[model samples]
Target chain A: MKNKSIELMKRYRFFAIMIVVTLAILVVKPDMGVRVYSLAFNSVFEMLGVLPPIFILIGLLDVWVKKETMVKYMGKDSGIIGVLLGFFLGSAAAGPLYGAFPVAGVFLNKGSRLANVFIIVGAWASMKIPLLLFEVAAMGWQFTLIRLVMDIFGVLVIAYSMEKILNDDDERQIYELARKMSQ
Target chain B: MIMTIIFYGLAVIGLVFSFVKSREKTKMALMKALKAFENILPQFLGIVLLIGVILSILSPQQISQLIGENSGWVGVVIATVIGSITLIPGFLAFPLAAALLENGAGYMQIGAFVSSLMMVGIVTMPVEVLYFGKKATLLRNGMGLVFSILVAMVIGGIMS
Candidate 1:
């Protein structure tokens, strides 16, 4: 029991330190404390709201989507189709970039091409379809359209660039890490 | 709100279909989901708190003041730096950027901020590293940072 508790503490050490720091801020500056507390509370709520469905979908995808199917669609030789699918999957996703990481890990585990996975991350980070509405509303169509085009281009460039940069050993290590994490 | 509904709806449909197909696999999926969530929970909590601290210190008003219309390349640099370090949600970030624009912040600066905010995540690097190793994480963020600068220049050129 003690060992388990210690392990838990180690896992949560950063969070613990943050709590201490927040408390210290609260004591030192009550106004900043209140702002931080509310901001943190809102983010916590947002995180909870967005995370459940994503994790559940990821789990379902892991079970239902066969590795062969994933590879066929997104593997090294999947080509243009894989690229389009990666962008589609990512643009369709709803959540923050952090939420995309686990899904990316699952993609790697499922034999997805490295470039495809990077495309997904890039799309998730910037080109989400739903958020595009928000962007257009706030930034105007001209600004939004330009940024959208640039972002799509940037995603492709970054994805392929990373793919080219990483050696065979790096790719294997990434895949291995994903497999271990997903398991 | 609509997105949330769509997500939950899809998840429910998936769960129902999986359960109908095989109860054992459904159970396994739930277990995997739970385990994955647990694994990342610590990092998530830490990131949330870190964001809270960063946002509180650098409020939207301060951000606008720092990146005014004539702030030029220096402002873009500062904007990208702030965006890279902080993890602001899109909902808040968009409105904040719009407000910054209204408050005389340059297009280049806002472009840099938005692009970097989406692409580069210094605060969430721990979680990213857990999934993608240090080398890949660093390289991706480096690319993202460089790309954000490019994005800023393009927006500045055409828009301004």
Candidate 2:
């Protein structure tokens, strides 16, 4: 029981510290504290709304997608098909960038090519289609279209370069981490 | 939003199909998801709270002043730095960028801010490091920061 409680504390240390900090702020500056809570709560509410289905999809992918299938579609030799799929998957998603990490873990666990996973993340970060529409509306079609074109190129460049920079050992370590996390 | 509807629709369809195919596998999938979410909950809470604190402190008026018209490359640098640190959702970010632009913030600086806001996340680095390790996280964000500058330059040249 004691050990379990200790483990829980370790897991929650950062959260606990932040809570205390928030409380201290509340004491010192009630207005600021109220703003903090409202903003934080809003975000938490939004996250709660979005994350469940994403996690479910991730879980399904982990359980259903065979390693061979993932490798064939997204592994090192999957080529342009893999890249397009990565881009599509990333662009189609709805959620924040952090939500992409666990899904990326599933991809890694399924033996996806490093570059493809990187593309997925890059797309998730900046190239999301729905967000692009929003961008276009706000910034004008010219700005949005140009940025979109450049960003596709940017995503590819970042993905491939990052893949090249990672040595075999580093790749292995990341793969291992993914494998452990999903299990 | 339409995106949320699409996500839920897809998830429901996928879940139904999985259930039909194999109840056991569906169960396993849900369990794995719950475990993954539980594992990250603590870090997620911390990150969100940090974002709230940062955003509350950096009010919209302050942002407009920092990146106002004629603020130039210095404003771009400041905007990019602010973007990198703050974790604004893309939906809110675009509208806010519009509001900033209307309030006299330069397009170049807004470009830098939007690009960095999407790509580079300093506050969420802890969650990223959990998945990609320390070195990769730093390298990716570093490269992202550089790329955001390029994006700003391109937008500036074209729009100006």
Candidate 3:
């Protein structure tokens, strides 16, 4: 029990330090400290609201989707269909880029192609539909359109290159990490 | 708001269907998810606090000053670095970027900021490395940094 508690504290050391820093800021700079609390509260609220369903969906995907089925759609030899699906699913997502990582973990656990997974991450990062609408409204359609075209090209380049750069051992290690995370 | 509802609705519907098909499997899935989430909760808590502190330190006014009209390519580099380090939500980021743009920040700088803000994540590297490992996470962010620069240049050329 003592060892487990110590391990937990080690894992949470960063959070503890942040709390201490925040308290110091409260003493030294009250206004900035309040801002930190409010921002942190809002983020925590958002995370609580958003993460449960996402985790449930990931869990369901893991349980219901067979490895063979996943491989058929998103693994090696899945081809253009896999790429298109990755893009579509990512663009349709409704959460922050961080949220994509856990989902991506589940995908990797299920034997997704490396490039396809990277494409999903790229699309989630740069090309979500709601985010695009916001960009167009705030930055003008011309600016949004130009960035969109460029970002699509960048995503493709980055995804393919990331996949190609990984040797078999590196790829295996990543897969092992994903398996551990997803479990 | 609506997105949250949609996600919950989807989850509920999927859960119901899964339960109807097989109660045992549904239970197993829920257990798996809870375990996975528990494993990462500590890191997520740290990330939230880190972001809160960083954003408080680097207020919008401070950011605007660094990347305002005369800051040029130097501003783009600084903006990208700030964006990578910070972890603002999309809802907040767009408005923040808009505010900076209106406050005399250059198109190139704002472009770099927004692109890098979304594509690169130095703060969330621990979470990413959990699944992708250190090497892949670093490579992706390195590539993302390069791409964000390209994005800034293209936006600067066409928009400005």
Candidate 4:
């Protein structure tokens, strides 16, 4: 009985919180539940359909993507070229959020710099030239161009600042070693 | 509905297997389910709340007005920002985008919003921190937000 209670508490805590929040909304705003439930359920259904495929893809990637190749190109010793490669590869492989999760996790464990991991995920989740082109054909070229430029520039800043701000000694050591070798 | 069934079926299979199999295999299945639940639940609720706000405060007509094709670059920017904070899959978002387009919302704005909404999420901030370290999470989300805006605008501009 005690064990069961503890397990239930652990698992249901968040779900309880959700219920309380929903109830609070109901009390504050009559009929809120109707709209919220409608929206939430629909969104949930769609997300469910997408996540499994994304996870399967990531699982396959883990199995198929050669570890040695990742080391040779995206290894700790690699430089700016490594960063560029990371960016392009991430952008090219854009998929669901769940998909990127394990992929990023594997990369982190395998010596991919935290900074590059950050950038790759950002680029992958956000940038996809082919998809953007479809959106552009619908919206406008000028708007599309401006937005793309801003995004790339912003990602660069984000990657740089995250590296600097996190202030991890390990990353700094790698960055400095790479910098020294170029000179 | 189908996913729920699959989850239940898989869960039962997992349980029965665990019951018969070694502790190691059983533990692994439990861990996977726990991980999936951990990732899905909170952000899922967060999304529900945000959608509530949009529905209660902004009418479907209002959404069309604000994100209208003629709303200009500023409208696209606003949509992109909104999208970054909201988390939804492409399947739902794209369909909604199709509808919004019919309703007079610009493709670029929807595009930006969709990309950002899926890619970036303030809603999942806590989970992201737990999954990825604080700095990495912040940096990735920050970039996702910015890039999504660009994606929307570029898509919008080219199409328009």
Which prediction has the highest lDDT against the true structure? 1
| Candidates ranked, most accurate by DockQ first | 1, 2, 3, 4
Q: Candidate 2 — which residues are off by over 4 angstroms?
A: A1-6
True contacts kept of each: 0.70, 0.66, 0.70, 0.17
Stretches of candidate 4 above 4 Å error?
Answer: A1-14, A23-31, A60-69, A92-99, A169-183, B1-60, B64-81, B88-120, B139-160
Ordered from best to worst TM-score, the candidate numbers read 2, 1, 3, 4
Model 1: DockQ vs. true structure: 0.80
Candidate achieving the largest DockQ:
1
Error of 2 at B144 (Å): 0.5
Interface RMSD of each: 0.9, 1.0, 1.2, 9.1
Query: On residues B42-77, what C-alpha lDDT tens digit does candidate 4 reach at each position?
Result: 544555556554555555466667888888788888
* Candidate 2: Cα lDDT at B133: 83
Q: How close is candidate 3 to the true structure, as a TM-score?
A: 0.96
Model 4 agreement with the true structure over A86-152: per-residue lDDT tens digits: 6796666533454455455656545567667766766666565544655456544654566566667
| Model 1 ranges off by over 4 Å | A1-7
For every candidate, C-alpha RMSD to the true structure in Å: 1.3, 1.2, 1.4, 8.3
- Per-residue lDDT, model 2, residue B54, is 97
**A21-95 in candidate 3: lDDT tens per residue?**
889998999998999888888889888777899899989999999999999999999999999999998888878
- Please report how far candidate 4 places residue B152 from its true position, in Å: 9.4
Cα lDDT, model 1, residue A126: 93
